[model samples]
Target: MMRRSLTATPGPARLRISLAAQQNGCASGATEVTSARAAIATAQAGLTAAAAADTAARTRYLAATQAVAGARKTMLRVQRQRPYRSARVAHAKSAVAIVTKTMITRRAQSGKATAALTAARTGLSIATTRLAGATSRWKTTCAAVKVTQQKLTGTAPTAELTARAAAISRDVVTQVRATFTTADATTVYGITVHRSVAFAFQRMIDDAKADGIVLSGGGFRTRQRQIELRKINGCPDISTAPASSCRVPTAIPGRSLHEIGLAVDITSGGKTLTAKSAGFAWLKAHADEYGFANLPSEPWHWSITGS
Candidate 1:
């Protein structure tokens, strides 16, 4: 009689536990997605700020260059006037000497010659001072131009920082793509990508289609499939051959982003994708907004991360 209970308590408990686990998984996915979005936003903001700073520095540098040019012109003009002023000073001093030596009837004439010599010397001194000021201004402006150019291009430390930021952005995108699950796989434009990326790909495809482009591709290969392709493509054994010798630049099994369901090899109406194609051009112009980037070596290859 004790074993006659019809209710299954453990079954309901197990069902509840499973449901909770599923909910937690969904929550974790959402959190990851949100984090990825935040990272993208931060990267975009940094790029914008860098661009603005570069523009400002360029403007300042151009102004400094013009200032230097003006200073040089002023210095040249002063230099030209300096020789004339010196000649006038010499001539005036000779006049004074001549007046003093020849006992001139008018002492007023001697006095006038002496005053003219003093004025000429003063004018030469003023011209020399102006030239020196212009030279100093030109040097200062040249220094300013160097500093601004360094800021615009970046010094060693600034260059390293910029490189690190770029690496971080690429890493974040890679991490997001790596988190994709089997359930996240979806068909897009005759290809497959993670559900998270599928919408973006679809948008890109639709937009391209509107512009008279028809795109197609396959994506999301398994490790075994990748291995098979590698063998068929006459890929050199990665363990023995240098990676550079591979005919197809396919990654080793289990090592490809394509295996993670975030990459695709796209084509336009069965034609090979190339830099010249409209579809490729469209993707180049707009794919980054959708969190996709083209693999530089392979025009047909596009992924969440450039790697």
Candidate 2:
């Protein structure tokens, strides 16, 4: 088919006729198809961009979840080993390191290994500091305990009297009774007196107590032990009771070590030796030199050099 070009004529009637045909026919509308196609292309571009964004967000969320899970697992494993003790920290660190390496190797895409490494390092640093403190405390406590045990084992005055002598003296007085006319009645040390020994023992106790042998409020157990031995062994005071009966009660009617003055009570309390009395302190430090050993149960009691 051949197409013809239409030309405008200079006549009002012809222009009117052309306008009427254009309004009545579809051939006159030509640009609407092109505009519709352009709109469809723009909508497709927007949809593609939105889908890509959603995919990226999903990937990021998944990665974060994996990282958190790895961190929690690592923490649980480390905590299980009890890292509070210094001796165990090395093991904890090694365990954390191994777990971190494994996480990195197995989950390469999530950066799990890097996160695990950071957590492990932080945990190890804190654990090391705490462990050091705990170790130091343990050592200090052990040392204190050892010293206390040794002190308990050292000899005191109660080791001196024979069983028979002790029984006889105990029957007389049951315990030593002493009073200082010038000062308070205080305990001194333990001596082996039984109304039968020689004058030498009582002299030692007299000299020690008169010279202020007991320290005020020293070791209580050691002092008390000494006192019990003195009482049971018939220790002396400045009283006028016969020296022979000093170690034995006056009621026993037999010659006691106190009569010979060979035993003395030097304890003030149980498990303690006082520092306030020079005599008591001297006994604690020098009693061994005189062949005297402290009794664990009674700090004040002592046996003779050979007995």
Candidate 3:
């Protein structure tokens, strides 16, 4: 909590991250539901067309059946007259056979259309289910948005917390200053800093104070101070040690931003800012406006170049 030095690590990042993720999920869910509804519409249209085709086919089939029946009666009457071989009887028989075939064809067409209609109805049902699933998922993802939003906006930190942060910053300033003579460095608000960065940092701190957050840190380490940190933090060869080799992750002497007075290890409530600190949340949201950049691996570390 360089901002929440007393609170917890990883809180602020998660709050903002959760806030963004939930909002995106809500949008995706809405889109899915919209697509499902479109599918339902298409299915309904297909069903309607199929039903109309089935009706037309049934009508034609019925007409064909009636014609076939009349033909049969005429053929029977001609047969009773005792001339089965007559051209009239032959013609009547042929007419009946033709109508029977037409009737059967229409029946098949009607059956096929009915089957299509059934499939369309099934498709519509599936689409509706999809929409329901999408809606449910969206609601689930958005559930956490309210709480995380409040976290990012920040609640007023307790007075005790504020005092602790200021105290820690003061102690750190004294210790860091002990590493080198302060006579040659430019000091602003008690933290040694590069001249180019002093103005922006002051404005940023003032703005933070206006918004109820106290910002403090140590800066401007001499090259010798860098070597001391590496040794104290446990790097085998302090001067040549890699940043990660030290127990506290010290940068090699010449490479450190502190030596040039461009970086500060920030503090709030006397603790390093954790993701959950109200102080941290404020900085996370607004530090960039004043041209400060943070090192991802070190929440307390921020510099003009963000190493």
Winning model by lDDT: 3
Model 3 agreement with the true structure over 158-186: per-residue lDDT tens digits: 57545654465445444544554444468
lDDT of 2 by residue, 1-307 (tens): 0001122333423433443343222121212333334444544454455455545555765665576566666656656765455545556556657665655554553344345444555555555555555455544543443343233333222243233334443443323323212121233334323332222233344435555653222211233344454466674642344434555322122222222222333554333443454445677655532223344333443434211
Better of 2 and 3 by TM-score: 3
Models ranked on TM-score: 3, 1, 2
lDDT of 3 at 149: 47
lDDT of 3 at 274: 76
> Which parts of model 3 have CA positions greater than 4 angstroms off?
1-9, 82-85, 150-307
Relative to the true structure, candidate 3 reaches a TM of 0.47
Candidate 3 at 13: error in angstroms?
1.0
Point out where model 2 deviates above 4 Å: 1-29, 85-307
Q: Per-residue lDDT for 188 in model 1?
A: 73
Best first by lDDT, ranked = 3, 1, 2
**RMSD of candidate 3 to the true fold?**
17.2
Q: What's model 3's lDDT at 299? A: 85
- Screening candidate 1 with a backbone cut-off below 3 angstroms (N, C-alpha, C), the clashing residue pairs are none
Q: Pick by TM-score: which candidate is best?
A: 3
